[model samples]
Target: MADSSAPVLLGCDFSSSPSRRKPVVLALGRREGLRVQLTALECFDTLAAFGQWLAQPGDWVGGFDLPFGLPRELVQALGWPEDWLACMQHYRGLGRDQIRAQFAAFCRARPVGGKFAHRATDGPAGSSPSMKWVNPPVAYMLHAGVPLLLDAGAHLPGLHAGDARRVALEAYPGLLAREILARRSYKSDDRAKQTPDRLIARNDVVHALEMGQTRLGLRLKLSHAQRDALVQDASGDSLDAVLCLMQAAWAQQRHAEGDALYGLPQRFDGLEGWIVTA
Candidate 1:
C-alpha cells in the first residue's frame, strides 16, 4: 500500500487547445524511495476542465510539459516587462493573432536557423523554442498553461510564489525519452505514421524506465497491464505523462533532501524557468 502522507505526484502531457480527440493527459503516481509507481492516468478534454482539476484542494507536486516562462532575450527585445510575474501578466492580455504577428515580425528580422530566441533551459533540455508559433506551438502552451497554474495558487519555485502544498515545475519528456531511445522515434499523432518500429521503440523506453536505466537513477513501478498500456499507445501521450511523473519524483526526492528549489539549479534565470531535471 502507498503512504497515506505522501503528496500526489503528477506528470502532464498538455495540449494548448484540447478536444475529445486530443485531450490533455495526466499520469498520476506516488514515490517510495527510488521507485515511482504508476497509479492512474486521466484526460481532460478542455482547458477549463483541466483548470478546474488544478484548483481542487490537494497536496501535490507536478511536472507539466509546458514552458513556464518566455525567453529573456525575446521578452527584452520586444520591450515586455522584465519581472517574471509582470511579464506573464502582460502576455496574458494579448490575443493569439497579436502574439503570432509580433513573434513572426521578430523572426523575419533575423537569419534562418537562429531566428527564434530561446530560453536558457531549451538548449540543455533539448526543447523547442518557447516563442515558436508553429510546429509544436509551445508559445501558446505557455500562454494557456501558466495562467492556470497561477490561478490555482501553485508554487513555481524560481518564478511565482504561491501555495506550498502545490508545486509546479516545467518538464520535457523528450529529455528522458532521448536518454533511453537515442532519437529512435516512439510515437506520432498522425495515424498513418504509427508504424511497428515506433511500437518497438516505445517498448524499449518503457523497459528502460522500469529498469531505472536513465541517469536519474529512479525506477518506474508498473503492473503488467500498465506496462502494456504504455507500450501500446501510438500517440505516446500517456508515456510522455509517465516520463514527466518520473521527473516529478526526482524533484520530490530533492525536496526531501532539503533543496527548496526542487532540484532546479541555483543560478536559474527567473524569466526563462529551468527544466526540473535539466
Candidate 2:
C-alpha cells in the first residue's frame, strides 16, 4: 500500500469538449523517493464536471496536458496583450469563429514553411503549436482549459498566482512518449487506426516507463491491473495521462530540490508558457 500522507500528484489529458465517448482523463498518483506510483484514474465527461473537480480543495501538483499560453509572436502579431494574464482575458472574450478568422489571416500572410508562430519551448518539447485549431485543435483546448485553471485558483508557476497547495504546470506527454517511442504511433482515436502495431507500441511505452528508461529517471510503480489497463486502452488516453504523471513527478522532484519554477526554465517567455519537462 502507498503512504496515506504522501502529497498527491495529477496528470491530466484534457479536451476542449468532452463527452461520455471521449472524456478528459486524469491520472492521479504520488511520488515516493524516485518512484512514482499510480493511485487512481478519473474521467470527466463534461467540461463543467472537470472544472468542479479542479476547484475542489486539495493539496496537489498537477501536470496538465494543455498549452497554458500562446506563442509570443502570434500574440504580438494579433495585437493581443503582451502580459500573460491580460492576454488570456482578452482571448477568452473572442468567439471561436473570430479566433479562426484572425489566426487564418495571420497564417495566410506567412511563408509556407513558417506559417505557425511557435513558442520557445516548442523546439525542445516537439509539440503542436498551441494556436492550432484543426486536427488536435489545441487552440480550443487552451480557450477551454486556462479559464478553468484560473477559476479553480490553481497556481500556475511563472504564469498566474493562486493557491499554493494546488500548483498546475503545463505538460506535454508527447515529449516523454517520443523519447521512448521515437515517432512510432502508439494511439489513434479512430477505431480503424488502432492497429495491432499501435497496441505493441503502447505496451512498449509502459515497459520503458516501468524500467525508468526515459531521461526523467523515475520508475513508475503500478499494480498488475493498472499496468494492464494502461496498455489496453486503444485510444491511449490513460497512458498519455500517466506520461504526464511522470513529468509531474519530475517537477515534484525538482521542487523538493528547491526549484520554485517547477522544473521550467528560469527565463522563458511569460507570454508563451514552458512545458514542465522540456
Candidate 3:
C-alpha cells in the first residue's frame, strides 16, 4: 500500500565503527504490489558520510537496526536526567567501565529475577531487554546508536522528534531471521559461529524473503548477482539492510492505509517504534 510514487524505501544495517570496516549498508527500494524492488545497495565507511545521506531531503521510511531509547525504569532508578538528549550525553561521557560498573551496581541492588527493566514497546515488539549487554548487546547498541539519529535530526516513530515525511523505526533482524529458522542458529557476525551452515542459512533466509515468505507479505526482488553478492558478504551487512528495507516497505504500506505514523500499533506499551519509510 506504499505510495508507488514515493522515491524509495531506505533500510540500514548499522555498524558501531564505520571506519574500521563497512559500518553501514543501505538497501534502496520500494514496494510494488507484493514485491520490493531492489534498486541499490550501498555501504558507508563513516557515520559522517551516512549522516550526510540522512540529511539529504528525501521521502523515505527506514528501518534502522538500532535501539531507540532506554527503559523508563532504568532511567528513573539511575536518577539520570529525565531529558532524552541530556541523559544520553551523560551516558556518553561515561567510559565503558563506568557504564558497566553503574549497571552492575543497579543489578546487584535489584532482585535476581528482575535485573533488567522493560520498555513500553517491549511487549509489542517482543524485543530483548534494553539493558541486556551480551548476546544482542542491545543496551550498548542503543547507547551507541540513538544519539546518531538524534544528531542527524531523524524522526523516530514512537520515541523521538522528526518530520512525518521522513520516518525512522527500530528494527531487529534477529526477529525476522528467527521466524524461519527458529532454534537453528543461522548467522553470526562473531567469527566463531560463521560456519558454512550459517552462511547457507543466511542464504536461505534471503531466498525466503525473495520468495515472499516473510510475515510482511512482501517479496524482495533481487537480481541473481545481487543475491549472490549478499550471500557472499560474510559481514551480512547487505542482508541486514534488506531485512530493514522490507520492514520499511510494510510501514509505508500501512501509512498509505491512513496510519500517520505508519503501521506501528496504537498500543505500544513500552516498546519504541522502529522508523519506517514514508
- Leading candidate by TM-score: 1
List ranges where model 1 is wrong by over 4 Å: none
Can you write out model 2's per-residue Cα lDDT over 1-278, one digit (the tens) per residue? 55567569999999899999989999999998889999999999999999999999888899999999999989989888999999999999999999999999999999999999899999999989999999889999999999999999999999988998899999999999999989899999999999999999999999999999999999999999999999999999999999999999999889989999989999998889999989
Native-to-model Cα distance after best TM-score fit, residue 119 in candidate 3, in Å: 2.3
Pairs that collide in candidate 1 are none
Off by over 4 Å in 3: 1-4, 81-98, 123-126, 269-278
**Poorest stretch of ten by lDDT in candidate 3:** 269-278
Pairs that clash in candidate 2: none
Candidate 3 structure quality by residue, lDDT tens digits, 1-278: 54567758888888766764657788999887788898899878887788788878777788888777677778888898766667778877776667778777888898989887877666655677777776666767676776677666777765556666777787776677767677666656678868898788888988899888978888998888889988887767788898888888888788778886677766453333333321
By TM-score, rank the candidates, best first: 1, 2, 3
lDDT of each: 0.94, 0.93, 0.75
Clashes (N, CA, C under 3 Å) per candidate? 0, 0, 17
How do the residues 1-278 of candidate 1 rate in per-residue lDDT, one tens digit apiece? 66769999999999999999899999999998899999999999999999999999999999999999888999989999999999999999998999999999999999989999988998899999999888999999999999999999999998888999999999999999999988899999999999999999999999999999999999999999999999999999999999999999999999989999999999899888999899
